[model samples]
Target: MSLKSLIQGQKPLTISIISFLLMLALVIVIGLFGGRHIIGYLEGQLVAHGIDHNQEVIAGMQPILERGLQDGAAVSVIVSNFQSFIEHAEPFGIRLFLVDRKAGRVLADSQNRAAFPYPLNQLLDSMPRQLNGAPIHDLANWDGNAWRRTASGSVELISLHDLVVPANREERWALGVSSDLSELLVLMDSLHLHLDVVLLITYGLIGLLGFLVLRWVGRRYEAGLEQQVAERTRELEQAQERLIDQARLATIGQTASVLAHEMRNPLASIKLALSGVSRSEGLADREKQRVDLVLGEVDRLEGMLSQTLDYVRPVVRDEQPVVLDDLLDKVLGLEEELLSEKKLRLVRSKCPQCPPLRMDREKMQQVLLNLLKNAQEASPDGGEIQVSLEADDKKLVLTITNQGPAPAQEVLDRACDFFFTTKARGTGLGLGLVKRVVEEHGGSVQLGSASGKVLVTIVLPTAD
Candidate 1:
């Protein structure tokens, strides 16, 4: 896939991986250059330490060798004495060498460490030239390194400030000591191994921490995005609900207009004519019964038309602050006889300190009465109907719960829809009208049915 799409598709996962990879690459780059610098520094330190160790061995031998040569002691004997001294004195792989340049011969050699082309790789000079060149002799001068091949065919890196011994007779002598570089090589190898371990651990920790932190940030970002999406979805659903209600009201108005102008007048005329005939004293009992049946059917049709027109009618409110508990008492009194006939029990609860709500008294009465009827109808004989009211500073809530067989989820969802009724003789517009009135008063309605109970809840604004 293209990079942008991959990043956008699973932003949290993809971005975390990318961040970790980039951090890993950065760590690797830093380790490479930093590791090189560390190793170079370590190598230089090892070499310097070896040189200092070799110089110490030379210092001890200098005084004894000069006195022995000037006192006419044999050069061979002096070389032997110093070699034994250093082997027991300084604990290192130090070798001593002496050459007779004038006799064109080796004077004394310890370990056969270096062969005749002496100082073959001489790299620096910092010692006395000779009395023959005139001027003062700088006794503490230090020379630089030299490379040589031993008779055994191995190579050694050697450093010595040339020690000029006084000439005895016609033979001139050169004396110095060299330290084998093998120890330096071994130290560098060990140092390199340690550096590798340190770099591995350092970068490994950085990669792990960087990945965890980056992943956490990405997840948090994704969570924020998800919350925003959910909020927008809720807003869209609310907008759609408003649009559907508007469309439904428009359709109902058109149908209501047709029924009022067309069928309502004819049905009224038919009912009036039938009533007049049925009242005629000349009619027999059989004729009177048939006329009354026709009139009854006419009355039913007219009732249906009136119900539809009422539901489709626009609401006009005379709003005032009304106490809900008193209204509820009167509505309950009207249904007392009906509740008694059905063997139903009424249960009421209200907040004692509840405030009055700003609403249309007539419209709210209709809403409460219709809800009470639904609760009464849904309950089995001897079952309970619970009416509850609660009030807060911002709003007032009313709830009615009826004991009944559990309803389907779809029924609860469309419970307040226009003309949606489960009753055999229902016009299906009762709850629809209730919802319209409540919404007109800037309130809301909710219906739920579950576990052998049906519940309806209404919320209205409190008085300003």
Candidate 2:
């Protein structure tokens, strides 16, 4: 795969790994440089210790040599005394040498005369001229078997050269001491090894822990994204179903509009013929009653056709302030005959505090008539229908309820759905039309079965 694609595909895991690798690299670099710095510091301390040891040696031997010289001891006697002192003194892998400046020869050796490789004249000639009253020190690496008895079978040697002048003497002496650094070097190597092991273990553990944490977080994030995708898919499916339902409703509305228009002329012709038959002198009383019944059915069909047309058409509202009690009284007056025919009692309850509402007068009247008609039709013989109006905050609430067989819960839920009905002769446009009108007036409608009755509540905004 291309580098960019690979990086993007596994972005989180890749980023975590890259970060961890960088940290590990940083740690490794710091360990290396820090280790070298520590080693250098230790080596410096060893060098300082060697210088101190050389000074101590010089201080101890100087007084003894001066005493021998003041007693007029011979040169051989002084050399013998120095050798005896060296034999009795502590040996910390250090060897001392004495040299005569005038004779250009080694006077005495701490290890052995054979251990001195170069003559005193050659050593003095090679050294710097200025002493500055301080010993000269040098570091040398020795690879010979002469240091086989030492710690590592090889040695780092520190050499110090000091100039000594005796009282009443024209000759000067050179005192040299050499110390081995093999043991210190061994300790430094062990320290470095241990540091490397610890650092490696620490980095390994940290990298492992980081990897596990990243894996866990990645899994959780992936699961969350998957859940979101599933939820989105479900929402899309529901939206698609709604779109299908709307398409079906649109087709039904178009067909109903055309059919209602086509039936109107024929229905009018039939009604005219039925009216002429009822007025004829030759018709018997029974025939006339039958004709009147047919005329009533024709009128009912016309009303249904008109309602279908209204359902299909858009509403045009001319809004104005309307008093709640006055509007209810008008609708009830229109429904008076139907209520009497069904033997249903009307009970009106008006809250004195009810307020005027802003609505289209014609549309609001139609909504109240439809609701009252539904309550009349659903009520049993001598059943009471209750109509109540009250003001709630900034709105007017109206409720119409009747004692009747309660509608099924499912039917009540879809009571406002277009063309949905439980009644055999229902056009199914009454409640739907009421809902449309109320909504157009910035109001809401709800239907429910409660307390052994079907209740419909309408809320409309009050005028300021």
Give all candidates' CA lDDT scores. 0.73, 0.73
TM-score of each: 0.61, 0.55
Candidate 2: which stretches are off by over 4 Å? 1-253, 319-326, 340-360, 388-398, 435-445, 457-464
Model 1 worst lDDT run, 10 consecutive residues: 122-131
Clashing residue pairs for model 1: none
Residue 180 CA error for candidate 1 (Å)?
12
The ten-residue window of minimal lDDT in model 2 covers: 139-148
172-226, model 2: which lDDT tens digit per residue? 6656665666778788789878867777777667767777777788799899999
In TM-score terms, which candidate is top? 1
- Prediction 2 global C-alpha lDDT: 0.73
Per-residue lDDT, model 2, residue 264, is: 83
